[model samples]
Target: MPSSTSRRTVIKTGAVFLALGVTSCTGVPAPSPSSPSTSTPSAGDGPSAAFTFGTASQPLGLDPALSSDVESYRITRQILEGLVGVDQTTGKPTPLLATEWTESDEGRSYTFKLRSGVIFHDGTPFNADAVCANFNRWFAFPAALRQQAPGSSFKGVFKAHSDEASLSIFKSCTAVSADTVRIDLTQRFTAFLQALTLPAFAMASPAALAAGTADVLNQVRGGQPLSAFATNPVGTGPFSLGTWDDASVTLVSNKDYWGERGQIATINFLTYDHPQTRLQALLDGKIDGFDAVTVGNFDQLVKRGMQIVQRDPFSVMYVGINQEVPVLQDVKVRQAIEMAIDKDTLIRKFFIDNTAQASQFVPPKISGFNNEAPSLGHDPAKAKTYLEESGYNGEELKFYYPLNATRPYLPTPEKVYAEISRQLTAVGLNIKPVPVDWSDGYLQKVQSPGDHALHLLGWNGAYADADNFVGPLFGEKNGEFGYQDPQVFSKINRARSMPQGQERDEQYHTINVQIAASVPAVPIAFPISALALSDRVANYPASPVLNEVFTKVQLKP
Candidate 1:
């Protein structure tokens, strides 16, 4: 995550466009398009008083363990704190609830020294025992429960790979002392630290757990949250829940906060599913800020004198190809589809300013982005040749996409899909659009084998690591996207085990290059994301990780 100083540097250089080579992806010289520029508020400007933010969607729930989508994550971070936090500038693990930690036994064991004098929002003491209890509960959550509630994104990282003992890497969490907890792993997993930063690993109040707040079994069977957990979340952050419902979420400041208290007394996150409505709310001064600003509205917002903060590229919009489907199973067919779409034209036609066409899975800031990787060019003739070689006989590929959900990476899903569908048909492949409401587990359906042939999805780095992208998308054979390429899988594993250095980076580069050749998915673009703020808002934290902290935010008098 970039700090305020570095963020300002990026703004001055228009680095979002330069870093990803946004305009140069096609290897064809085209006139440079105008991109979104950034500026720092002089502290004398922006909204005054409590911050009220409107978003395009609502969180499924506030429990960190049960929320996976970005809307949920944005709210969850305010209510929970993990054992580890991220350094704003470096995007590396730093101490949070846990003051310090040490690794031993060749990285198989980790002991964390908990910060003292901390208490949950419910007034329960936070101790090593609480940490152990939270860990045990996560490990004990039924795998069946995970299927019913796809929000448990931690399943990929925590659940055993197989029934075989050796295949699983998780061991146990034990309280070594009143202020220390030790976690044991079955192996030396290099991405363990990165994994800890995920919301699933966040520490919740043990008292709430004891009260049966997170009833995973009941939640799985009934599709209803245990009201205690859902309605009244308990965490050790700088805010406590004020009110929560489907329409709006309100958080009040924690006056007795252990860390610095937030400047604003309250934050109201109102759900505005319509992009235009949400933007209008900000424009009309009904709200102070919002994210996922409507496309083609930057100039309008700038004209309105709004304070816009654009993040450096840290996400990838892509098409997920399910290999289990017959036609898609053909590597040539997959490559043909990948080569058919013109990403450059799509960006210009549909995307907002500064979004770059992606050639590989991870973004430029991530460790493994290969500058020398081959670009998947838009060539209709080449696409046709590949389709002919594969002997595809006009089978209708079920191309699934979501409706009513606007994400930072894929803001206009329907339009983007339409463009891609048009390109695929022009290349002689039959295309069928299967549109579903995004809230109806659209992403899960695509990731599930045989349910989809081609689907549109995207990822913003959960933590600023390459492993965060590869491990979730392609680690296990049954991982997300259901993409099975033996060479790609093997190379990814080899890359995951190596430490962060030249050797690890080289291995990752090799793996990315291999994935491109495999055509498991079409890497679309690294989107330039922004947040709209009112004139009187100041020090509104702009995080590269998109995990904005609200404690330091201020409002003019």
Candidate 2:
């Protein structure tokens, strides 16, 4: 997922501001003036049993391996199953397709016992061979394809760089028998099991793969305009793809699902980029609920009797500086950029009460979070001093921000960018604000190396492990920041290889502090993720790892 930095985007216009109560983006009211009716639920003629929610961004496609954004993951989770599932309440790996597993070869190999008597939606048996096939396909994804298409977000989890001292822990996956699969790792990686819990590693139907439809990721990378799998997807989960269009995507319950059938017959996600429009829709009862809810409208939504569910802060919203940029190459300049913004003020102006200012990339709950890292002071004088110390010439710093999608951490990106731009300007920096469409162009550009000078990005955790935070963005050279710190990389590798405990946590904490001092990105704030639901909705599913299982959700009347 765009870090919740890979998670998503959001926007602006004078008329939009006016509808949002004429308040600035940071202070704007979320709901439209027109109030929704407080009608009671009736047995008949009430809302459909189908649960309808809104997505702030449209998913790129339904192919899990090809998808890299939170929106795509949202849909993917409903349609697919990973070998391991996350326990929502405890944030630990739970059983899924693979009922149990054993670690051997000194933590270098894992043997999984597949769940028996399961079939894909297409009637093909799911077995050890299917698991191997999926692994083979992932391993075979051409390196060149990463450049052509939005590459697989799970690439790092599966493979390691050849040139670096880093060893590829994933050596091979083999089917030892019909009910068992053995995976050999080149080395021990403590986070390997946790990484398997990501949706990107979810087990897709091998029948779909054999039938040629599951090759959407590969085909799109070769320059196909669009992939068929995006609209028509086949999976063994509790829900199957129903209808997919530009406006909405629907999922119908899988009656023949291996596990308990979904209580709700249908799961519909309406694509609404604008927060006000989504809020109005909720108020009018046109939809049941929505995610990435605007905090500014929380009171109004509560007054309207909407049920609000919140997750502890798990994502980090930050200002990513491209180190390759000439102006940002100097450490002093990067530190100066970090000092320019007043994160406390921004958090107070935009986020919910629970949201806390961040000093490191990882949130407080993560094992490796550096609680003692010194927070950068909001000192324009010091910022100017650093700029002068760098002996820098005034250059137009291209500041990029996404325009039409919002994540839990970044509810109002345009407003956030405006404030950030204002802060930078006050520090005597030449900044050029560039707004790009969230899907049309923003994501690809920001994730590509050297395409940005400075960008506003956030990352929602896919798993609870510290590796989830440090490995993706800084393990090697990441596309977003283009940062390549050898010390940071070494520590990340060492931490991942060690078993989960205080020792491992200490290693990660050390790494985070070193990273904080390096200033790869300005750690901003960890915003609390929230969901708004209508009264009829019940047993709503959510996880700090961002997992939401639809099978358990129910609707009243």
Highest lDDT scorer: 2
lDDT of all the models against the reference?
0.73, 0.74
TM for candidate 1 is 0.88
lDDT of 1 by residue, 193-247 (tens): 6677777678889888667557543442113333357556788887888997768
Over 346-455, each residue of candidate 2 has an lDDT whose tens digit, in order, gives 98787866589888987776666777977667888999999999956788899999888788879989999999999999998899998987876576788887558999
> How close to the true structure is residue 234 of candidate 1, measured as C-alpha lDDT?
85
Model 2 C-alpha lDDT versus the unseen true structure: 0.74
